[model samples]
Target: MKAEFFTDAKPLTVSKENFGLERGPLAHVLVNAMLVSDTAKGGSLQYQVGYQLVYKPDSPGKKLPALITTPDMSSFCRLFLERGKHYLLGGMLDQNGGARVDLCSLAIPWKNVTGKQHRELLSYRCD
Candidate 1:
């Protein structure tokens, strides 16, 4: 599968613009993980991919969810993460406390994460 499915895709920057404006505290999670599974949910066509946390630099020894939902974006753009591949994922915690990521969020392959990009992602405040 082509990792560059999202043309002009860039690493996420450290800015409030990357997060939602929803009221209440936002718990952002950024981790280096391996894509464990990818499956389309029923008829909705949305994918609920699972990832094994390989590294969580911000919150060491903290427990975090392994699965993150990917909204169905077939109409526009979609992120297709290959199982067994490592990725640097960053996303906000939804109201349900579940982690959700999409084409708009940081979902870059581990090999593609540059030193600068890694530092920038680490700079973000992760709860």
Candidate 2:
């Protein structure tokens, strides 16, 4: 998705009472990560992971795979992640331990994450 599309997105904020209400299970994994490289892997696009956000239990840590996968859909339906930009990615993890992002996932530019949002993310809990 384009960063421009999120220009007017609602500010990311979470409170103990409103956290899951707004976010729901939008993603099982969430992080502010930079795209290191993009490689065509079979039918999916594998993006090399770079600098990653550390948000305790939700961060995924270093074991968060070197690559994150997304569908290689047609131009109009696919996600275009730039190699150098950082994104706040929110998506599911497959059984094999690989993460998968789709057009519907909470993928947004890292710059879009406000200070309050970052703090909320840092203290995010799955409970």
Candidate 3:
């Protein structure tokens, strides 16, 4: 399974909200991330942490790639998401219609968690 996140943040632009286009600055990079089942042994999430990086400095250059990792050596307190679950992300945007989003953290943390490293007792699927 796979997941998708969207945002309008300008983390890549030094202008704070602009992509350096109005200011004629170099471009920063952005990436896409998803939450999937971490099907590793003794894994609590049954989900894998993955990301799709956006790079290349050119128009639509290599639209990033989806990345995933096993839940090996992971713990609780970081279960901002679950397996087969779809998350909605938002952030600042550029004038040229590009999103400068950050994928390393969650704007909202999930309440269904304990001090232990684990996900909620459920599995999800997309439409």
User: Could you give the C-alpha RMSD of every candidate to the true structure, in order shown?
Assistant: 10.3, 11.0, 15.1
Model 2 segments beyond 4 Å from truth?
Answer: 1-42, 56-62, 75-77
Q: Residue-wise lDDT of candidate 3 within 1-127, one digit each (tens)?
A: 1112322222354564433522111121222344345555444322222322221223343332233222333353333444443333223234443432333323223232343412221222223
TM-score of 1: 0.48
Per-model C-alpha lDDT, please? 0.45, 0.51, 0.30
lDDT of 2 at 108: 67
User: Which candidate ranks first by TM-score, i.e. highest?
Assistant: 2
**What stretches of model 3 exceed 4 Å from their correct place?**
1-61, 70-77, 89-104, 107-127
Task: Give the number of colliding residue pairs in candidate 1.
Answer: 0
lDDT of 2 by residue, 9-58 (tens): 13344456433222212222233244433345356666665535534433
Candidate 1 overall lDDT versus native: 0.45
Q: For model 1, state the Cα shift of residue 52 in Å.
A: 7.2
Give the TM-scores of the predictions, in the order they appear.
0.48, 0.58, 0.22
TM-score of 2: 0.58
lDDT tens digits, residue span 13-76, model 1: 4456535311111123233343433345321122333444333333355444555556444554
The candidate that wins on lDDT is 2
